[model samples]
Target: MANYNPYENMLQTLDLAADTLGIPRNDYEVLRHPEREMNVAIPVQMDDGHVEVFTGYRCQHSSVLGASKGGLRFHPDADENEVRALGAWMTIKNAIAHLPYGGGKGGIKVDPKKLSERELERLTRGFVRKIAPIIGVERDVPAPDVNTNPQIMSWIVDEYSALTGQWTPGIVTGKPLAIGGSLGRNEATGRGCMFTLLSYLEKQGTSIKDLTIAVQGFGNVGSVGALLMHREGAKIVAIGDVHGSLYNANGIDVEKAYEYANSHGRSLEGYEEPGMTRIPNPDLLLLDVDVLYLAALENQVNEANMKEVKAKLILEGANGPLTKDADLYFFEKGIPVLPDVLANGGGVVVSYYEWVQNKAGFYWSEEEVNEKLAKNMKKSFEEVWAMQEEFKVYPRLAAYMVALRRLVEALKIKGYNG
Candidate 1:
């Protein structure tokens, strides 16, 4: 996994999808690289009165479809390649969901947890100022990922608005409700995962109630997805995060786990129930279960342990959870893997809605937001499934095919100018 390059992984899938569609590489070669990438050095004053410089990157993989949109993560491992790959995946995800947006992703190389509140705010503002020139209501919008959230997004909106001298809430999504954020934006990604999984199960003439699931990652996406799945009557056999993992074949209380993680800095290190047994973080992927919901980091199930995975179904709630080889191993084994472009697209989809509402200066109720989300998720998954059937390929490839076709069509319509 140390040698795993996410951008290269993205290219592998992109090439295969284009090949599957019988499109020449030259004609669609523009999609092979980012339209633009900006790197910034943000220096902020620390609480101890010293200054620390941080590296940030914003990669726009495409603008041919429409405006660029994706998340801005603050992780210790955030880098240009990862951001670029995530940006490309955003393009695919948005196209899969039929959103009128391209793909862009940005992140800073720092563990946001290590920063004091004031320091973090200053660093965020500095980063925003550097990238503000290129982002806008209809250009590029960023949402939260990893250690960032609504509060962080609010800070971005405030900083960007301050710099622009105009009130522009659409410059970013995932803001607070009082600031034009959509009603269902917080749980959009996880809810989309649930919606796609349920749609798949329904088509198989089964229900989530009959499954025993293991969830890796207890953050907003993983925990929300697990809790929602639990509410649907699935037995959550195991759950874990960076600190540790826990297993209880009889089923763990997902709601309690959600609350506990929320109250404990988003770590599942010390929570224990009567039947729960502690396990290593890596072991969570190998657990014998009906479902493996990976809402964690990238390249988790790579070539090293792909053969040991026992999950009958894999739902990707995170971008690029499975390496290319792991994806092939499962596809050849006949297991249905719900790709991220289709499963976790609810975030970008709702971000699109939020951007629209921000521009329109109108808001919808939570019911309306959720209704629109569920309908889009179900329809997107069905479209991907149909593409999979038509192509006789893996769902991931099918999803990439769906997205790449849209990108190519857009390119043709726009011509090769600028």
Candidate 2:
């Protein structure tokens, strides 16, 4: 993993997909770089009256399909390379989901957990103010990712609206419901992963009830995903968060666990219940379960631990959870590793819906939002599954092929083929 670069990982996948598609280099070479990238210095006034400067980045990978769309992550490890890779992955994700959008991503290098509420608000507003010139409903739209959430998005909308002197809820997504957020946005990513899993299992003539699952992250994506899968009659045997891991061989009560975490300061540090036992976080990955869901950060399943992952089927809830070598290792071992571009696309799909509703000034009911999200996720899974079967490649490579084909066609139509 010494030479592993997220951006290079994306490019390597793109090259493999292009080669498989038999596309000439001239038709797809332009996609190797971002269309535009901006680095800004954001100055915020701390509560103690001292001014601090922060670095932020917004990278638009492509706009050939439409205006760019992605998320803004607030994390200490965020950098130009990671942001660029995420932007490229967003482009592929949108294309895989068949959404009319390109790919873009932005981030500020700061640990949001360490900031006070007021300081966080000031930092979000400052970052928005700096990127406002390039972002809008018709230019680039951003949603919440990682440490960012609906509250941060609401702050951005408020700040952007104040600066422009107009109501533009469509300029950003993942806002609070009171401020034009979509009804089903919170659980969209997890629900999408669930739908994809069901689709794959159905194809294999397996029932959700027959599977046991272990989730490697208990954040919004992991917790919601575990709950939804449990609702579908799957046995959730184990779940873990950054704090620790919990296991119950007789199946954990996902709903109860979710509520417990929510009420206990958004952590599972001390969650207790009958039949549950504490385990090491890494041990959760090696659980004797039928499926393992990776909803944590990138590179969690790298070459070092590839052989330790015992799940027969792996689904990604986070972006780039598996390194390139880890993915290939799974493929060689005949373990199916679903790609994030297809598995976690529910969030972006609903973000598109929110953008549509905001533009139309009409809100959709939760039922409507959920129905449409499920349909889109199923369709995307089928397409990627078919591609994998046709190419005899891993799901990750197949997803890249599907997305690259769509992107290359759009670029050709725009006369960027040369």
Query: How accurate locally, in lDDT, is each candidate?
Result: 0.91, 0.93
Q: Write the per-residue lDDT of candidate 2 for residues 138-185, one digit (tens) a residue.
A: 889999998888999999999999999999899888999999999999
Cα TM-score per model: 0.98, 0.98
In model 2, where is the ten-residue run with the lowest total lDDT? 261-270
TM-score of model 1 relative to the true fold?
0.98
Write the residue-wise lDDT of candidate 1 on 237-321 in tens digits.
9998888899998999888888888899888868877899998888899998999999999989988899999999999999899
Misplaced by over 4 Å in model 1 are none
After superposition, which runs of candidate 2 have C-alpha atoms over 4 Å from their true positions?
none
* TM-score of decoy 2: 0.98
- lDDT, residue 380, model 2: 90
